[model samples]
Target chain A: MNRLMIELNGLKLEHPVMNASGILGSEPEHVDILVNAGFSGIVTKTFTKNPRNGYPPPIIVELDNGGYLNAVGLANPGINGICPVVERARRHGKPVIVSIGGSSLSEFIEVSIKAEECRATAIELNMSCPHVKGHGLDLGSDPSMVYTLVKEVVSTINTPVFVKLGLCDKIIESAGKALEAGASGVVLINTIRAMAIDVYTGKPVLSNKYGGLSGPPIKPIAIRAVYEVYREYNAPIIGVGGISSWRDVAEFILAGARAVQVGSVFMKNRRIVYEILEGLEKWIEIHGVSSIMDLVGLAHRV
Target chain B: MFKPALKTKTEQLSSTLYLAEFKLVEPVHSKPLPLQFTNIWIPGVDEIPMSIADYEEEKQVLRIIFKVVGEGTRSLRDRSGFFGVKGFLGNGFKTRGHDRILFVAGGSGIAPLPLLTRYCTIDNCIVDVVWGVKSSDMLFNIEKVALNPGSVYYATEDCSYGFCGMVPQVLQYIIEKEGVKWSTIIAVGPKPMLKSICSTIDPSIEVYVSLETMVKCGLGACGSCVLKPLPKLLCIHGPVFKCNEVNEFLESTHD
Candidate 1:
């Protein structure tokens, strides 16, 4: 059998496919689909210490290409609302990653601490949502703040801390700084800064006026960031961007992602996870590769 | 209860339309409702909510009617020639007993109205349809709907053809002139139109509105489709809701 299993901070996954945070919601109402579709792990929506209303609508806009710009403002039902989802996912016997985002260091720590009580296998610190006005990418962009945040969360939680980073300038330096401060792994490339104007109304489509872009448009940028950070730090990288198919996932793996997190694609095609896993298996068998681990960072060596 | 299923594109209806049908593959729950919706996924496109226009209980075939709205719809419409959908989601509309059912449709709102009309016709329930469009050219399959022996009214804003007025005006005229005691009013159209109809009508008369909201996951997981009052997600709670539970939503919009 082509073993697709990989290790992240001592946790073993059945496969390398994981749903990116924010894309998958707190309720696993779609878990059967995710599990049957062959995803190794599912990430819950970003949870906050308290319930947030997020931004007002039109939070999402369609770009000219098939990509999208979303400023959902991280609307979540709070940490307590996420427990049932975590329990349901655990019952399915698949790895579950709980994603938590906060405006302050204490909020982040509290949410992460709350998530530890659930059955989530790990906790992903979402210091990288670009659309929110006060939080998210702002916290991620500042290297010192990221390090301090990561160190604080990692020190408090027993579960592995995956510091999700944004694809801003000097991302490699930022990823390196995050690892130095003690992130167990890194999730590279949240949505890129973008906006869309309604030609008829002659105004921006999103309520926030500007949002973060995702999908095919960001794939190239995300792959570049993953390659740069992986080459520089050699820390486990959870590549997330525009991974819609197996080919995209393969590219991320080759670029040095230990595993890949899918967001927009899951929104577009829930079965994409299984299709990718099937395709990866087929590709591995055809190429006579013994395992997915052997393919990690193959492009970097070449 | 509802389950998510993977559906393949059996055929494309038009350049911008598709005839993709999915097998229940997995039936999360069997509901006795005439309206059902799914949170659909088109690879590399967008994820949005769509209503189940037709369903065959034995075959477990669920049909969804959608217009090419945005990136997700475009992607699904484009890739119908390639990869298809892989999720069935949301709580559908419930229709109980054979009552006088009036369907009001505008724009792509025409999709689920026809299905409801067909169901009511087969069940020998009284059915009437008021379909509106910007102009006559925007109208689709009026004959198919009119053939049911149930009254079919057409209205266009510009009055290129048919009645020159709005759907609510037509409905008001019918109720006033014919003295038709409509047991239920199910409306799916632009939010403003639905809002207008809800505001003008008496709350004692039953009215159900299929709300238009941004839906991503469609399983109530994502808060994208939440309406105020109950803070319920349209994807799971309803694409269709009784007039009272949603009066707060309509009231909030007016403010």
Candidate 2:
């Protein structure tokens, strides 16, 4: 029995662990590396309508808590690169989710159509990318805008739509609005807005000054975000935040994440996903559970 | 982790090239052994990747030679400058099992050659260098840094220095005239130069090139410096790679 298998709302994955968008997956070779590492799904870097060179260096800074603050500015190959990227990811026979980024509605709509036409298994609207302005946090912070954009994108394509949101004052409300607008699922927690300063240089570490923080430091917040979102509507949530171990996966599952996307941690351990899957397999075998689904929202019952 | 560097010194090596030296507030993991790199951050401007030309343990100084190409280098070329440094990051040149190693440097590509030569000399391997510059003006007394070399030869395009020709031509003459066989050739330079060397040298001789790309997280988390074909992250797999391993990288990139 493939206890780790995931099949939810028209989306199917051999395992619940996925490679989070933007950690890698910018090119076909990067995809091959992730696929070979045993991820059930491949999430490509978020794409804008045109190529962006991104911010000049000093874009990422490491924290003591095994986290990173980065303002990559949504650097991508632009929409025209969809065919080769989607085709390569599909070649591995795994589900591919192309993350879309844009400042306005047309860009999102245009990229989604191209990604969908290239046979992407699903489309992930990057409404929560923290580092890039106008493209993400600004769009996600507005609940009414979330509803409108999600609805417009949902009506434009036949592929399942997953809304990725960052942590904001009205995160739960925005997530509610997305689901209400016909989103198939939600990816909770992109990154928290943060920055660092060098005492010597006396300047902010990242060139953009403010960037999104990811990795272990945000776990507690991400867990609470996932917990609250799942409780409010019993919505299907894909958890992502500072996940590095099988125990982390178990935590997200118990908190109601149907599957989890991993980022940041890959920088430390490329094979962490396999370790997580193995650990999940062993944990479920011990719990006498038939599938990971059985453990979803177990915390809510308590 | 990038910390602020102190006592930074910038010396004009030539018209186009300059050498910057600074001491980190705290020691890095270890001296970037073999030929590792560091991402030097210029505040409010840009952070660029530089190969460690030399490091002095007594003074705790990190030395790098760079060309002033853009605003980043222009701001960094001050006599006493302040910046953040994070490294000994990325895998640098690792000498394969070769008895004799020849380093071929093209212009600013000479950045990694000094430290590489020092390490290889300690390993007691026969080492030779053929550094090609635009003219004698581009040669900046390299012997001062690359000491104890079996021999150091300079090749200038204008024929104003040691050898009167481009680096590849001098390389061919050296190989044929001396009837000497090199087990390995570590070439660092522009894409066209590295590619040309690949075509000029014998297939039996192994060629390893240090690739320069925009490296963001130096730790390999960001895909900013990803290489082609095998798709190895240059920060981790290498800033240095053998010709065969990254065949597509050479063919895909142009000068």
TM-score of each: 0.63, 0.95
Stretches of candidate 2 above 4 Å error?
Answer: B95-98, B253-255
Candidate 2: global Cα-lDDT? 0.84
Worst 10 residues of 2 chain B by lDDT: B90-99
Candidate 1 Cα RMSD after full superposition onto the native fold (Å): 12.9
lDDT (10s digit) by residue, model 1, range B136-231: 777656444333636778888898877788888877877777675787888888877888888777555688888877765453334566675344
Candidate 2 chain A weakest ten by summed lDDT: A56-65
TM-score of 1: 0.63
Top-lDDT structure, candidate number: 2
Every model's DockQ: 0.06, 0.68
In candidate 1, position A281 carries an lDDT of: 94
